[model samples]
Target: MPRAILDGTVLAESPNTVVIEGNHYFPDESVNHEHLTGTATETVCYWKGTARYYSAVVSETVFRDIAWYYPDPSQEAASIKNYVAFGRPVQVEL
Candidate 1:
């Protein structure tokens, strides 16, 4: 199993994460919703489709758009649709 931790909190823990390149994609429900503040930031991945982002807020400190997910992933990466993935500085433990 692998877990994504940030700001000393475990955001996600799962065994069914999809690894694309080196990033672990945890199902949306696996993430800690309380720590997320939805944002308008988005990026497009040529093969993975459009990605939506969420800022990670810890106490009074805010990490802008530190997590992302593909709401509508392409066919080649459909397995990770709506899966959340963390960015650097967020610890990923296996």
Candidate 2:
């Protein structure tokens, strides 16, 4: 199983994850919404389409824009649509 963690807390965990470019994309249902705060930040990936970010807020700490997902992905990355991927302060453990 793969899990997304922040500040020792599991933000998301799933066995059915998609690995793209070595990043584990966890299913939406596996994520803990309480720890995620939607952000205005957005980035475009040539093959993945536009990605929207989320800040991981745990206790008194905030990991800004550490997680992202494509709400509507390009055809090439349709399988990862709505799946979340972590980076930086958010740790992905396999």
Candidate 3:
């Protein structure tokens, strides 16, 4: 199983993941909502469509734009819709 963690707090974990561009995208249901909050941040991928972000707060420390998912992905990247991916400060334990 693979898990997304921040300061030892598990954010998301799943045996099934979609790998794109070397990033592991976990299913929406696998995420631990208590550690994340949606933000206004969004970025567009030329082929994957728009990505919405979430911030993680662990022990009162805020890590912004640490997780992202495409709520509505393009046809080419539809498999990843609703799948979350962690970046940078967030660690993915395999």
For all predicted structures, in order, the TM-scores are: 0.95, 0.95, 0.97
> Residue 70: error of model 2 in Å?
0.2
Query: How well is each residue in 1-94 modelled by candidate 2, as lDDT tens digits?
Result: 8888878899999999999998899999999989899999999999899999999889888889989999999999999999999998778888
lDDT by residue (tens digit), candidate 3, 47-75: 99999999999999999989999999999
Which residue pairs show collisions in model 1? none
Q: What is the clash count for each candidate, in the order shown?
A: 0, 0, 0
Could you give candidate 1's per-residue lDDT for residues 12-32 as a string of tens digits? 999989999899999987888
Over 4 Å off in model 1, which ranges?
none
Between candidates 1 and 2, name the one with more favorable lDDT.
Answer: 2
Displacement of residue 12 (Cα, Å) in model 1 is 0.8
Better of 1 and 3 by lDDT: 3
Error of 1 at 58 (Å): 1.5
- Which of the predicted structures, 2 or 3, would earn the higher lDDT when compared with the native? 3
Report per-prediction Cα RMSD to one decimal. 0.9, 0.8, 0.6
Ranking by TM-score: 3, 2, 1
Q: Which prediction has the highest lDDT against the true structure?
A: 3
Instruction: After superposing candidate 2 on the true structure, give the runs of residues whose Cα lies further than 4 Å from its correct spot.
Output: none
